[model samples]
Target: MKKKNVISVVVTVVAVIVAVYTLFPFYLVLMNSFKNANDIVASPVSFTGVNVTQWITNLSNVINNSNFNFWYAFGTSLAITVISLILLALFGSMAAWVICRNKTKWSTAIYMTFIASMIIPFQVVMLPLISTFRDVGEFIGVSMLQSIPGIVFAYCGFGGAMTVFILTGFIKNIPYELEEAANIDGCSPEGIFFRVIFPLLKPVITTVTILNGMWIWNDYLLPSLMLGQNGRVKTLPVAVQAFVGSYVKQWDLILSAALLAIVPMIIIFLFAQKQIMHGMVEGAIK
Candidate 1:
């Protein structure tokens, strides 16, 4: 019993050490954000002499800067993340259901394609993606570059593979018996999906949304390419880069912007962390 207790103590100490190591960077960012450039340069890690007003001033600088346009960028990021998640969840579930119910060669082929696409690195297709979007935009008489719809469309395409992959696995575990019962009630295929299958997907869908939301919110490269660095429509990450350059590399404002950009995501995780874990476990079990 004493030996087991010693082992548990060692494990607990190691876990705590790892947690602190992981969180130290975030602590440093938050700590330094409130300090001025001179203070930060003097002692980056220390919280001494920090003031609430200084933090407010730093945040104000970031928010009011014409280049960062914090509010606008925040709104843009929120819209893109929310809209993309909605579309991905709806369409991914539908696609997964179709693939699960119809176990034909075509459906199997499409599912395999989605799984295969997930393995292809984004870097391989990024340039071609840009050129393709440009050509398609020109052909369709709508600007696909540096537009909200363009970014959202890109997100749906890029995020679709993983979303379908996760949802398909969950859908496969859902018994065919429920679907058959719905059919006997004169429910059309569409009605069966909307009324029965979708409702049951709540937990797994929440899991997918949180997973995708974090990625889409923090994503820099895809948006940076779709919307140019200095474009009018900027997400939080892109705007932070522009803001830093516009300020001549002022780290104080830069860190403040970073903090602002991450606050929403942190709040979301705090609220939904339970649901996210529960959904993931439930999906895995199914």
Candidate 2:
């Protein structure tokens, strides 16, 4: 009993430490966002003037400085996220269903191919992909390399593998009995998939959507490479990066932009946190 009590105490201490480590950065950002440039630069360690009025003043300056261009960047990021999620969910779920249902040698081979592709680092393919896109654009007389849809396509290709993998595990657990019943009820395979199987996978779908949505929304590297240095087509992350560069280490504006970038993510997590938790539990159980 004494040993168990000691172990529990140690575990609780470790958990608290880890929680604080994770939260401290966000706390710092929140506090810094409300502070003036000199205050942040001179005494970042000191927690000062994080009151309502300060927050409102800092946030107002950030918004005013944005000149509504923030909304455009946000909208672009959202569109890419939504489009990528839809493509991944639809194509990934279909691919997973085929792999789970059809246990043929070809299907196994195809699944393995996707898994293999997942292991190939984006860095390894980055240059080659760029060259290919450039060549394709030149040939077709349509530039895809620095376009919105181009980035969306890149996301789908890179993201589909893991989404398919997770959805497959969930689908495999979904008892073949359900599919069998649907077949007997005068339902075609496509009908059964669309009507029944897809609906049942809602929790897992929500999980994937949230996970991938966060990633795509916050992604800077891909957009940087594919979208070029054009301010007009920048995503939120790209915009924030450019904002910092333009300000040239001005803490007030930089922290304000950082805060702007963070608020949406915080809101998203807060609202969909329950769904995320439920999906995780359901996925783990099944």
Candidate 3:
């Protein structure tokens, strides 16, 4: 009993220490966001010494001084993310259902293909992907590079593996009886999918949405590659990178930009947190 108690105590201490270590960087960024460059440089550790006016002034400087069009970029990012989520959730869940329900050789093969793609690093495929998109766009006589829709297409492809993986497990837990009932009630496969299974998959969908939303929101490489040098269609992550330059770096503006970039994601997660928690619970039970 004493040995077990000692082990438990040690584990608890380690967990708390790890948690604090992981969270400290975020806390530092949050607190320093309200400070000017001088205050941030002078007392990086002091959270309470921030001059609210200076913080506000720095923030305003970022807001007022930025050359990138805010509304346009913001709208582009928002549209891409939303469209990506819709495609991911709709197609991923449907594919997962078919894979779980059918369990045929083709389904297994296709599922394995998705899983294999997930293991392949994006860096390895980046060049080929870019070339492919360029060729396709050239053939179509429309430039896909630096286009918003192209970014959405990239996200949908990249996000599919994990989304399908999660949704597959969740779909397996749902009883087949529900589908039978729907069939008896004059429901076709399409009707059953939309009316019966779709509603039941809400928790899993919510989890996928939150997970994919966070990823697509923060993704820098995919957007950078697709958007090109102009940076006109830049997302927040790419926009924040512009603050760092060889001649002069504005740490204050960079930090403020970082903070602003994360605010929307934080708000989204907070609102969807309940659904995420419930999905996790359900997944655990399954």
Prediction RMSDs, each to the true structure: 2.3, 3.3, 3.7
- Tell me the TM-score of model 2: 0.84
Please give, for residues 1-286, the per-residue lDDT of candidate 2 as tens digits: 9999999999999999999999998878888887887788888868765566766777677666653257777888888889989999998899899998999999899888887887898889888888888888899898878778888888998898878878998898899998899899999999999998999988789878866776788888888778765645878888777777667877777777787888888897798888867765554454
Ranking by lDDT: 1, 2, 3
The clash count of every prediction, one per candidate, is 0, 0, 1
lDDT of model 2 at residue 55?
A: 68
Candidate closest to the true structure, highest lDDT: 1
- Score each candidate by Cα lDDT: 0.89, 0.82, 0.80
Regions of model 3 farther than 4 Å from truth:
1-23, 47-49, 67-71, 246-248, 274-286
lDDT of the structure predicted as candidate 2: 0.82
Q: Candidate 1 local accuracy as lDDT? A: 0.89
Worst 10 contiguous positions by lDDT, candidate 3: 240-249
- Please report the TM-score between candidate 1 and the true structure: 0.91
Q: Residues 194-258, candidate 1, lDDT per residue (tens digit)?
A: 99999999878988887788789989999999999999899999998888778775779888988
What global local distance difference test value does model 3 have?
0.80
